[model samples]
Target: MNRWLARLLDTRVPALPLALFRIGFSVVMIIEIEQMYRFRRLLFDPMPYVIESTIPSGPLLLIWLAAVLFLLAGYRTRLAAVVHYVMAVIVLGFGALPHGEDWQGDSLILTLSLLLLFMPSDRVLSVERLMERRRRAREKVKDPGPVDVRLIHTVFLYLTIGLMYLDSAFFKLSSPMYLSGLGVWAPSTLPINAYHNVSWLMSQEWLVRPLGYALLAFESLFLFLYPVRRLRLPLLAVGALFHLGVMFVFPIPVISLLVLALYLGLVPAGAYERFTRLWRARAVSLTVYYDRLCPLCRQTVAVLDALDLRGAVAWKPLQDHAAEEPQLAAIPEEELLHDIYAVDRQGRIHKGVDTYAAVLRTSGWLAPLGWLLGVWPVHPVAQRIYGAVAEKRAREGGCRDGVCSLARPGAPAAEPAPHRGPGRLARPAAGVLLTAWLLSFVLIVPAGPLLRTYVTGDGALANRLENTAEYYKSRVYPWTGWTSHGVFMDEHFVNYRVQTMLVFEREGREPLRLPTIRPDGYTGSYNSGRLWELWTFETVKPELPLDQVERNMSRFVTYWAVRNGIPLEEGRILILQRPMDVTLDRFRRDRLADNLSQPWKEVGAITGSPGQLKVSFTGEPGNQSGLYGPRS
Candidate 1:
């Protein structure tokens, strides 16, 4: 029992997966932050429905941006992780309250950032690692060749992911739409959610029904099987393809990207190494020779080494190899010391700024940078800058004494020592903390469902269980709300589509529609989809009173009018429901040409000025307005 516990808690795996995860996570976050910044006004501005002020200040977003950038560079990684996580909770969690833009993807990002705070992601593939390596080289510390992370770190990450899948699968299994094999098809009809029209493909029962079942099976089995070492790689591959499909088909790019980032954590260290080795083998190779005795040159080379992720560039000291290497024999030692040189596979030497470009070209991601530097207009300027820097370094660098000693290659001084992890007491404490965390996670994730399922009758025990379930639902579920993975998992999703239309009745002009319906779709540019989400929540749920919905719609229209410089002294905000049954019936009968010819039914309408609008409901649950045809 002790042996098994030790293996589970103390065994170390390669740190590459965590490092890669940090990179992907940071990149996705930066993209998400950019989008938030773009829509800051709409997201942070006050709204009629939001009773309390949840506005996140503009400077907070800038701070969040800085934190993510620092996290990406791996400088003070733990501190950056903390800052980013806090900022996400404030800016993404609370700030999105007014616009109702907060999503499960945001929660997932928060969870990942929180996990990153405890991870040693800076141990490799970071600016911190480069600095540490250089410091160790200077101090003559024995090199610890590669970094390793505790197995428990990875275990928790995978555990969280598996629980997410399991939670979603359980909900999907209980959903009648999924059972009927119309889970994917139902959501495809929602214009607000879809990016491209795939109704024809989704309507094909033979293709979509099996796909629905396969998706359900995949999610259901993932929790149990993904942790198996032999099955992990295959599952990860399928997961990637699945996310890619989601990204292409849906407008929720942020969600798909975050999920894909999480997939990086499941990659095995050995597999990552093997794939990188294969990539490096196929890449072009170059050898860079620099002045070793010159501190500036050595520092520059160290930075390049950090950037050389593909391992395509080999660095050698010109002082040590000038005499032995035939390629360098032709160039004078004075010229070699004056500027850096790179020899390509064809034995052609590139000098000064050109050498930098050649070396950069061998790097996978930096190749575009190399091409840019070598372009017609930029090349001359780069050459001039390189020449001036090289001249200054050659004159006053550390080599001025002409007798500076250099450490031999492969010596202790040339490599960094392995990182010493937590102390003896701390390690055991970490183990205990991790165990407790896993236990709590396992217990809390399904607490609501379990409580609701077993506890029954109106006794004290049942009341307690009901309270516990409600507590979990209102509090804990927000953080772990991956249960709604089956998009449009209800019958109403197939029955009708929700749309909000804005009309501006100007004094001297005809009424203008805020989003003019085009042949392609709704063409409003400013946060139109977010508004659709908001209106859908209001109309479908019917929890909010008609007056509150009207007030909110009035405020939204006024905000849009102000932004677009439109005079909206009087107008009507119409929340319409378009029946989908007729279209689905047509689609089923192979009459695809006029599938979208169904007329809209007004569910509710708010008329008058923004301040004194009157609200009324027509096609509500009890009221009949042809919303569901003869069934109503």
Candidate 2:
């Protein structure tokens, strides 16, 4: 067993840090993604579409987090590496090229991701591979390749990342932006008007020249130095020095930390392991005192104990011997026996309300509970009630042998009952409430971020045409025995005519039921096949005498299609305008004759008042008019 453990660590040592870094960085990236969603940028902006179009990322973000937690739990090394690497790239791409507007955090994660992709950290203690080996050995399957894949991947990943810095340095040699004292290391906090600062440094030809040359030289040399194992540590050490200098001058916190971590990775794995062991050894647990008598109280205590965190909570009944501990010794035996109290890991005693939050924090399940505990008025109310109960218990005659004695001399007294309250089932209720919360988050929340696009006015009309064309292509055009409706144009609307147009023409007379028509037809004639139109009232011209009639026709045509170019007569052509004169028609024949004698032209021939007429004819003569709007 010792030999096996040694062999596993040896194989996994190189990849272990890389995995740890990847897991850490990925968690931050997931948080950023959530922030983007909160800001609406995830749904409305570019990053989400670039990746989520292929994978619905809202749910995928949760999956990625779960996978990383599994990795931290030491389960499924190879699978975790693969899953982590893929997500890291989706995250990486967004930080890399044109979209990489701010590259600090993402660049580091990308580098770590590439390293983990090729590492063999899973061979050591990964739960998935270990379980598989056990199950497979029983069937006699051969074990696969060298266990040092993780190391090899890490070496390559580091080399590539070092190359990025080298290229950046090299490019600065020629970039005016870098040379004008605007180089990454330039101080953003330089005193205003200081001649030695970046603003003036750009003008110092001799100084800038050597600085540029040095940057290129150091960067280019770094690429060659990083590959040699003996020199690798020195190279990383020098890189850390450079980053530290930049951190002092420039304001790039993310970049500086990333470089520091990379340098630290060069330290021997034994050192990191030792450090973690010491940290874990010094860790302490919190102690909670809960009642064990009431059924609800006992059950709650059991759950708290189950999540006891290795010793986070210690239960003591009203009669337990632990009540005699030094911390409780300060209070009189009667006072101590009256109410429950908890001593935190720091040895500070919390008697009532504050104890609940401490227990939750210690239990490591406060994420769902925090909001409830955090609510404004409710939190204070809960705390007050808890305090009241604790004080009331204290006021009762000191509980003795699970029974109460008198507090006031000669007062009628009853035995003190066990402490119970509305929140007694907080533990069990948490499980159910947490499940419900998670379900809502998993379904409705993700669905809410799904992308949708909407357009109004002419765009909607155009989209309708496009949809109609698609329907016609896929379903309607194939089996139908109907003729194609060729396109036509008219004064008030454009039309497509099939077997429906001829119904609109009644020789020399307006069609039946034509005068009562309204836009959309629902309030008027539902079955009537009439032309529909709509006008922009917002753009109306007041002097266009017939603006109201034109506006009405616009809406009418939106609901109806008016077709033209099909000849009404075999002989002549003409122009006609029939005014709906519910009020002005009272002038009678004198009005009719005056309207007829007036010359007519194509309606759109010349721009005039909306009611003015202009028409052009290429055929024999004719005249036409049709009724519109309600008749008196």
Instruction: List lDDT for all candidates, in order.
Output: 0.64, 0.40
Cα lDDT tens digits, model 2, 87-191, are: 655544442121222233454555555455445445443554455444333223333422333233344445444545543553444344344443332222111
TM-score of each: 0.82, 0.34
Residue runs of model 2 more than 4 Å from their true location after superposition? 1-16, 27-35, 40-57, 88-98, 101-111, 122-150, 176-182, 185-218, 227-234, 241-265, 270-632
Q: How many backbone clashes does candidate 2 have?
A: 23
Clashes (N, CA, C under 3 Å) per candidate: 3, 23
TM match of model 2 to true structure: 0.34
Worst 10-residue lDDT window for candidate 1 reads: 584-593
- How many clashes in candidate 1? 3
lDDT of 1: 0.64
Find the candidate with the highest TM-score and give its number: 1
